[model samples]
Target: MTTASLRALLSHLIDYAGLFPPAAVDLPTAIKNYQRDRATGDAWMLGAFVLPISRARDVPATLADTAASLPLSLLVGPDDLPPPDLQVVSVEAKTNDPAVVRQLVERWQPAMVFIELNPADEREVMWATLRELGAGAKIRTGGVTADAFPAPETVVNFIVRAADWRVPFKATAGLHHPIRAVHRLTYDIHSPQGVMHGFLNVFLAAAFAWHGMSPDNVERVLAEEDVANFQFTDAGVSWHCQTLTTEAIRAARREFCRSYGSCSFDEPRADLRALGLLR
Candidate 1:
């Protein structure tokens, strides 16, 4: 990906503020929306499935057949074993036993393995089991979804762990907008607890974990509080400079919705606000 392309795509992966339909929209419609707003870039566009395992098991044969026809990378719940044409399978770490997990990996060999980093006991076992699976088998990553309460520090530590293990993973939930800001309104606990801020998380992950940057140095970048600072070109040059937190990113999303009338990448910068949806 070119520097500009990488920066542009990362912006979308970080926020995902563009799609503004009511929550009750059907899956097909959501998929269509994504199709309409599709961005043409080398950076991967990770798509998600809202269906639970049982329901997904009954996916229309036509949908399954059409899945491989789609452009972006698709992800279905672990519980739901959609056809391989559907792309990645994100099995909930808790729902499946290790043997089951192992079987799924051996059977599908998906692009990624998503686990929810939970209680100390489970977390330890899950981490080790995943490590045993080894690299090139599948990309392994964890997250704290809306249904669970995970300390942000632990979440950050987990990212560090993944990096240490050379695991290239992405996250979702609570990260709705990106950034370390507090939601004083006590929004729906059913939703994921997003990062305190996108700028901080990206800077921390890149500087400290991915690039071996020091904490102090990352803190300095956070002091400036710019997402753009962390977004560098494939060539390592700066393009489309701007910094953003989860809140600011959300605010930007509101603006984007007003301007574009819908959430697709129809509006490039506006669409980028949805980057946080990566998780």
Candidate 2:
């Protein structure tokens, strides 16, 4: 694909989740960093600032002087409600029950509702409910250990299911780099290390699945660790023998895999540059 196409595919793909996990900075620090990212040249790649619903009230006061407003994605519970002025673009709720999801959606009336489901939950029922409600899904792709990373098959299944059901979804946790590799789980020097999913791997798989790629192919794409097998062009990205057109990728990005939350935006940017995908 052309550079323009690649840019379009990735536009606003990473939701800033600085308040979560390894980077867990204070609200003030997270706000400062988000503001800096918004002011940078690559700001177009940044999405909403994510924070807990309980902390929503603190955001306006904390960022009062620094940023005029923030596009937010609140991590909310089933009954939590964001303040009217929070400017929430989307909401992530931790619930496997469709009834609770329905209630939250009816009350908050967000642009998007990302409901997290248990791995063993009746996924079909949950996805069907989301489809009926016109909501979305959220997946936790990684955590602090090797065991935290879901199997490649699990992720691929989620993508295929969402594509089949036409349920848009977003991912959070452990996707800080552009490619899959063993990396430190946290910023601390003594932090544990594990194999983390690549943002590229997950999203590209979603695109391919959205275009009807077979489950095996999607799994291969997710497991791809060799950068040489993947090619980036002005028109679109190619993995091994499979190629996704720019238009297809853009459509998948828009309608299927919305975005992933990351604690550190700089890490993904740096990895992209090192791979020569960025200047």
Candidate 3:
């Protein structure tokens, strides 16, 4: 059974994006995978279906006709404004400019809007802007190539800024495992490998940051690839010398770092089991 700290830090933590590269599976196949995911008891960790606005027309009605109405997170390009007819619970776009983010919030008032920014960019001021506007920040942790992964310092910087401003944020790409490690970047047999940031490192960094850990200490957590350093208990999560109570982890997970997008839900689950994080 998963401990309280694990549950607190990981509820609805993965927004499946099977439609995006490196999985980049066809729509029908992606839908099938999501349907199968929803059938599992582990579905509680799943979030929305990541559907690109361009593929809005290709979605089958069966995608939403499940026991619970499926949540859809539409990925929009800079110029791709979604039509009013499309139904989605959230909209995601990349832009460091707060104006474009404001436009998204205006266009989709009720639905949650997350605006992506480069972690190395001036995210502190941008996060403050998002906080005042009631919008969320998004960061890409990794891509298809090794350089696609941002440095540990930048990621920790983002977490500090986002937490300081109380701006909610979500991560995308490169985080397919539960711990920081060198891993294959894609499903292809010859896929290039890189040092991918673990979901635990990122989210735990956020949780600890939200609870007032120093950025230096948080950076230590972010850079840690050793599984022995992390201890999950009924009361809280500990990373080396630092610890966050279960409630602190829960609050951060809910109000700050919301979730990460993944192309394969199974990869994360399998990795977590391999780490003995799951029984």
* RMSD (Å) of each candidate, 1 decimal: 9.4, 1.7, 2.0
lDDT of 3 at 182: 90
Worst 10 residues of 2 by lDDT: 59-68
lDDT of each: 0.39, 0.86, 0.85
Say which candidate scores most in TM-score: 2
lDDT of 3 by residue, 165-225 (tens): 8889999999899889898888888998889999999999999898899999999989898
Tens digits of per-residue lDDT for model 2, 1-279: 228656866789999999888888989999889989999998989999988888776756647655337888888887676577557789998888889989988977855889987866755789999999999999999977778889988898888888999999999999999888989988878888988899989998899999999999999999999877778787778887899888888899898899999998999999988888877
C-alpha TM-score for every candidate: 0.56, 0.95, 0.93
The full ranking of all candidates by lDDT, starting with the best, is 2, 3, 1
**Model 3 deviation from the true structure expressed as Cα RMSD, one decimal place:** 2.0
Residue range 195-257, candidate 1, lDDT tens digits: 233333443343344444444444444333345445543333231333333443333222221
On a 0 to 1 TM-score scale, where does candidate 1 land against the true structure?
0.56
List residue ranges in candidate 1 displaced over 4 A.
1-24, 39-51, 57-65, 71-85, 88-92, 95-97, 122-125, 135-151, 182-196, 203-207, 214-234, 237-279
> Which 10 successive residues of model 1 have the least lDDT summed?
253-262
